[model samples]
Target: MREIRQPGAYSYVYGKYEEPIATVKPGETVAIYTKDAFTDQISKETDRPSQIMSNPNPQTGPIYIEGAEPGDTLVARIIEIEPTRDYAVSALIPNFGGLSNTNITRTLNEPIPEKVWIYKLEDGVLTNNKRLSFPWRPFLGTIGTAPALEAISSITPYDHGGNMDVPDVKPGNTIYLPVRVPGAYFFTGDVHGGQGQGELCGVALEISAKVTIQFDLIKNKSINWPRIESDTEYMVVGSARPMEDAARIAYAELIVWLEELGWDKWEAYQALTQIGELYVGNMVDPNYSLVAKIDKKYALID
Candidate 1:
């Protein structure tokens, strides 16, 4: 196993794949250390978000997988996500989040007051005000390969899987990403201690983390979008605006995936109507992400 620390191994935007800091063969495990989304600018004393750096969400790497190439699928199996800090932070930004008046959803009223809350992580739980305590469900908030043509901001989630803040991307889950460039140029960061579906508040329990992941290559297997398989379910991810469109993209991919597995298109549609589940990954980002999922037990394949 190789290790890539935060120093000198970070990207603020996803673009033409950069040179790999480290190259690894398929099935090799790499431990990556990532900084918080705020780039470690916010601390217990930090009150205003404007004090942070302009370009946030620092990702770890563009790791070059030995056999990965365009038109293939890169399988990233998350082994572990351990927080490197004792405390995590969540904030109510001035004009961000699902409920607030954001740039897209303009309003005459003033922006919401900015408030930051720091939570302590202990015994697999995050607690802030004692009245509110919840189990930690740590996950990487950003993970993606470089886009085929254009450069994308680290905050945007798209087919290339930039900042898709999906909670399902946890340990034991395998995320399949399409390779658009040679070596796949994979990168990941923005560790979240825990977050609800939709990431309603615009932020979750943000923390730096040490993440262990194993990579696998599926030669000649191409996928249109990112797909994830946990121990119990198979999911397709989609990113777009107007949330419903994201849902549509996700379901479209799921339906196609089912059909490819030997079920008739209509048959897959009907089956999905009965067993499909939709989860909102993040609504706060530039492009909202939705996940269409179904249990593996319901698979039509023998």
Candidate 2:
């Protein structure tokens, strides 16, 4: 357990970066603490809009692992995500999202308000008004780490791990990230109780929360990109240009992964062609993400 003061530039959670609880053993559980996406604000029962601030996502840690090194894979298994309170708050700022660049030309569509609105899920729908529409699902807005290069990244999603707000990356899942630099400067924060795909409103149930995790070292799996495994599914994440292109890259990478894991290249290709699963992590950023997954037990293995 630790506290973070200034999360630095382009970070996800607010304030302090957290230190890993301990060297997580293969099946042991670890607990992690997190701040809200906004460093200074708290979820209050007010109807006012949050003041638009410079930084929205601040993260905790660069939790250095003792022997984590470059060319390695750090496997993180999420065990739990418990909210600190019953309900939380989130907001959408005027000029701080993927669509911000061209927002001026379409200001009317922009819903900037002096006060924020909170909606509730009414029978499988989000409704601030009893008559309006609803699209409600909840997820975290940021989960990532430092870049291999000397450069820093904003709290948004990148290969370095900032804000990759995907929906299915939740508790009881395993994440594998490539080790670019030594110790793999890892961090996490900006925990949302729930969020919909794309975070279209730019915010979710923002609040301070904690998580339990376990870490393991994948010895020689030289994967170039990130991958994840939930109890029921597997995902391969590729970040690159034009969503379709990135999606292709993601699938291609997974095929390579399957081959390297000892499948005959041709067989792996056939299997993937038959029943591989893929998803769009996010298409809003300059670099889109493609995630592919399959059940491990059923995945083609030699």
lDDT of 1 by residue, 1-302 (tens): 67887457478888765667678789899999999988888887456776665777998877888888899999999999999988898898888888999888999889888888888899999998878677899998999998898879999999999899999889999999999999888889999999999999888989999999999999998998999999888899999988899999999899988877887889888988998999999989999999999888887566
lDDT of 2 by residue, 1-302 (tens): 33333334434331223344334334445566676766536444364444545466566565655577777787877777766544456665655444543343345465454345454434545545565444534344555544666544444465654566666667877777777766666677777656655555566666666667677877655567677777666577777666677677777777777776677778777887778877665555445556776667757444
**After aligning candidate 1 to the native by TM-score, how far in Å is the CA of 93 from where it should be?**
1.2
Report per-prediction Cα RMSD to one decimal.
Answer: 1.3, 4.8
Best TM-score among the predictions, by candidate number: 1
Clashes of each: 0, 27
Number of the top candidate by lDDT? 1
Candidate 2: which stretches are off by over 4 Å?
1-29, 40-52, 96-115, 119-140
* TM-score, model 2 to reference: 0.76
